[model samples]
Target: MLRAIIVDDEELSVKRLKRLLSESKDIETCHTFMNPLEAYEYAKSSPVDVAFLDISMPELDGMALSGLLLDLDNAMDIVFVTGHDEYALQAFDASALDYLLKPVTAERLDKTLAKIRKNRGYTAAEPALSVFLFNGLRLCRSRKGQETIRLRSPKTEELFAFLMFRRAISREEIVDTLWSDLETDKALKNLNSTLYYIRKAIGSGQTGDCIEAGRHEIRIAESSLYCDLYEFERLLKQIRSAPEPSADLFKRAEVLYTGEFLKGKSYEWASEQTRRLEQDYIELLEAAARFHIGIHQPQQSLRYFCEILKLDAIREDISHEVIRLYTELGRKHEAFQQYRLLEQSLQQELGTRPDPRVEDFIMKLMR
Candidate 1:
């Protein structure tokens, strides 16, 4: 049996390899990485038997990651899997375990993977994962804490990440997200200006056609670095499928929050994505609370529910649950006060009454 991680910037390639590897009973797909830098980081933190990799990526390339990964784990060998044949020699020169061209044949991949298994007794070290834009009405969101060129809200940052995310965003969609109401000429000028700004912020020409901004579509540079949101989503899936109560729960919750999901922007809130993220945020809070509860820690549940309240005040169910916990812990007056506060907020915000269940609970409490 072989444990493997596929490192490819191409989704199709990743999908194919995953399908092929899944058919093999002796393989466990450890983790698939889209960026060399991330692969390098994870390689340091996780164990990987074979790295089916590509040569070019943002932040780092296959060659660079291969070299760095080798240093991190001298016994870890790289099996370069890519479209270009020219890099084969460089792959071998880097002392990579092997170089297998893309559109990978089962036989070749098996050979490469088998070679990796044959050398599995080795250990390696590795280390450790953006943006929104709206048109002439270019709305940029900067991270609340850092000014990382990647995290910053440059036009290019928005363009780059957007392309990476949607795999392509249309120029019209870009304009729509940024300046849906503007004239075509004005929109184009603004888009170009924003791109220039992005280029300046990240480095000249970094987000070129790789982030295709053509008449009908815009897409990330197929060869650029990976998006944080994508990786964040990937971790979310991992945590969901393998539900645990420790670091993964919190880490996944943190990533899904992503600082309010493109904060500081007011463009197209009605889009499916905007609605979806809002739902995910609420779900993550609930997930966090559930995990905490399962771990025999009611306080953790209490705190997560508080976070949920910050986003949503209508969840009288959670509010009441927390209040009951507080009361059961011998804080009766505190819980009663919580009911009063919620009643006041509901009246002030919705001009309505608490749900019947809550009203009954409060009535019972008052007695």
Candidate 2:
């Protein structure tokens, strides 16, 4: 029983491959991603025995995406599924185990599976513990399914989240940060109560030892946690330090930020971080847009521009860029429509219309 992921930009291709893969008894589960970036993100936290990737994909090609996946788990097999045969040589050079041409036959896929099994002996899937902090804090403890634990109280939940955020903090610091409004004795008492509640909530299991408390300090046992937030931050740092950051890396990080960090909660300490993460997400979108523009892929860049507007709708500058992209892509009507929406947004929200420059830009494009 092996887990596999199918990545292809084409919707029909992805569906077809997924259907075919599902027929195989060797495959326990088959996840499909039309977005290469999403496939890369899924592979990061999940254990995949083999990845069936399309050789040619927008944003990130199959070869480059496969390399990144291999970096995560070098033991995993890479199988390139494409309509082209020219890339077969290059695919092997990248250490791909097999290359299957498009409209893949069942017989061919079976052969690839056999090769993978021969290369890496089949083993039972292992249970994994994962913490997702994008839209909210959710715990998943196994490949079988996700586990969403309910805390005893809001304060207990906050206390657990606080520890996850700080990784490790002195008892004094924890009390000061989370319970500063209370009397010193009361604050310490509250902290103790909350810690007990948190322990009760997570209970004894794979995640039982995730939180460790000492006499003077408490910490998250990172080895016991596979946190999305940690991975997102790590990708951001890696991209910033890299001489030539990969757009796929940016997209992977961008996908992790499904919403504001710890959203729907009012943790005073977390507000600033939420804003910072959103800004980081916007910047990644900007970088991806810029990359598409550099490659003369206005359609791709336009998609990113629209996404930016979704996050920061009031950015007249971004709106202007989007209008320009719409115009360049021969979508004058959409360009006008975009302007009207921005116009309405500004007037209704900020008591103004689109900037005069934006109006002029659209008018020129219309002519």
Candidate 3:
């Protein structure tokens, strides 16, 4: 087993990472520390195959600690764990092997471990391509949790997204969806060229029969890809199928919705899917809000309520809920400000006022 060490200022973060690493048989936890100085001293005496370091630690950060660790053992692999995306380039600049975002998924961590194995001359499994459809279309091929390649092309990206949702479709149907405005013959030619580029962009040989085209229909082979949209849908299906929805299931669903589906994309075919995912996201947030409320966790409930309000500011019920939470938490000024903002937003956007229920609640609270 590959011996590994973890260092994070947050105790919970360290525990979470250790739990995740425990699931991987290929890795063994050698040591864990919440103090960077102690970790530094330990590293000097103990040799480890890999070190997972948190970037934002007090006094000594991951980047600086990495330099010190490398000075001890130049062959050691360092993986930076961070909550911020801004530190990605810097993490790589420090000659780190990989970086994982907060709330790291097991699937993602497996890929990171595979990378470390590959560097050590062990044969590693092929890493899956992670497709993020929420914020534009980003295709990432990763090994050991570090992005090896990112594929980008507007029309090809759109075609990939369209195909991912449908799985299989006739070339004629694709032509109609993406290129209906163009002449039939021209559209067919564009479709052919776009398919060629898509396969090339995604690595036909490496990805292996991921996109297959036959005499009439083109389909994406589902087994070869991992998509956020597909994963989100799967989680929703699981929750619906479960006899009793657990807190873990709802939290899992919440994490899948990193952002709005296909945000900033304006394909006619995508509009419906976009709206459906948005509605699902809002409902998930609402359910989480209720779940937290049921458990008497007002802070958590208010967080979900605020997220929902961000999507639909005029949601009177959610606004009322936020106000109530603020009042309960003794944040009276914030509660009053929230009410005023809602009142102003309604008058400006819809030429209306807060609902009578909201008005009454505000009056009672203000008194």
Candidate 4:
């Protein structure tokens, strides 16, 4: 996915452009700012593939911002969007890859993206490294008409995963985490050998560059690899921050969370991340449930609530929500069954009764 930032002083224009980009499904908006100065500051700290700038804003214009952004990262691509047609020459002079006239059309945006992709040597059809951490650890590089490459190595895979998790780590940390029992010199030698095997297993062409090792530290390049965990967390953040959550966005994010992070793995360091992501997944389900209910979609709400209960059966509030939704849908029998399950779970797990509010709701519903 192309990481992009959109800058527009106008809120409506920014929303419209974001909607269009979302529909395209190729660009991921890392940040959006009404102030060009703030956008420039963000671009300086983050790796952005493209900057979509609106030219007529006060304080700082898009053309000026493009120069600043390019100064920070000469490799960053810029596309100018403005209402004024005459600014096209100025935009090109500022080294913009493309100049877009205001009231940007989808077709025009598509053409502009095509130009950017071509100029950047980005092939939409290139094989992408897919790392699966939800069910178990699996790595595959996939391309349209080519055979998939499956990467396999126990120690090397673990090393790669550890680096991906930490982003960067000192050699001492690597030895402590992955080879703690060995002597310091042996651990250091093992780390180097494992890294070499990792590079070889994942293919030295692109994946080799992803793991950078210095004399003292090693880091996984964020831009050079794609992992499901990364995407899952990103989508969760997007869903949480959306001004108005839609069913489509919720569903898009929901699908990315296939299961718990590295579900079957017992890596000590992964346990905390696994639990955190599981909690976030449960919350996402709860958010979807509430959103569906707000929209008067009882069945959809029930579906999400049921999923939440599956992950966190002892959450009395969610259990109550499930019961309420089932009752709302005239499935009183199922509602009672859910209540019984909740009561049984609470009693078995905590040796306590259901919360008073849940009991009250059940009693009232029955009457």
Which candidate leads the pack in lDDT?
Answer: 3
The predicted structure with the larger lDDT, 1 or 2, is 2
Residue-level lDDT tens digits of model 4 in 125-210: 43346666776776767522134444445677678778878888999999999999999999999999888887887777876777
TM-score, candidate 2, is 0.63
Alpha-carbon lDDT of model 4: 0.81
Residue range 1-367, candidate 1, lDDT tens digits: 4667888888888887786676443465557877767777898888766677788776778888777777877766678888889887788888888888777655455566666666775322111102332111122223332344443455554554454547766677777776668998898788888776665555545433334556676555432433445545544554554424355556555654545455554434335665676777677778877787777777777778777777777678877877776766677787887777788888988887778887787678778
What is the clash count for each candidate, in the order shown? 16, 0, 3, 0
Each model's lDDT = 0.64, 0.82, 0.83, 0.81
Error of 1 at 25 (Å): 23
On a 0 to 100 scale, what is the lDDT of residue 110 in model 2?
A: 63
TM-score of 3: 0.63
Q: What does the lDDT read for residue 348 in candidate 2?
A: 84
lDDT of 2 by residue, 292-316 (tens): 8888988888888899999878899
TM-score of 1: 0.54
Tens digits of per-residue lDDT for model 3 on 1-367? 6889999998888887787786565675558998889988998888788999999989999999999999999999999999999999999999999999986666567789999988898853454676777767677775233564444578887888898879999999999989999999999999998888887877888763678899789998655666778767766755554444567778878887877778888887888888899999898889878888888999998999999998999888889999999999999999999999899889988999999998998899878
User: Each prediction's TM-score against the native?
Assistant: 0.54, 0.63, 0.63, 0.71
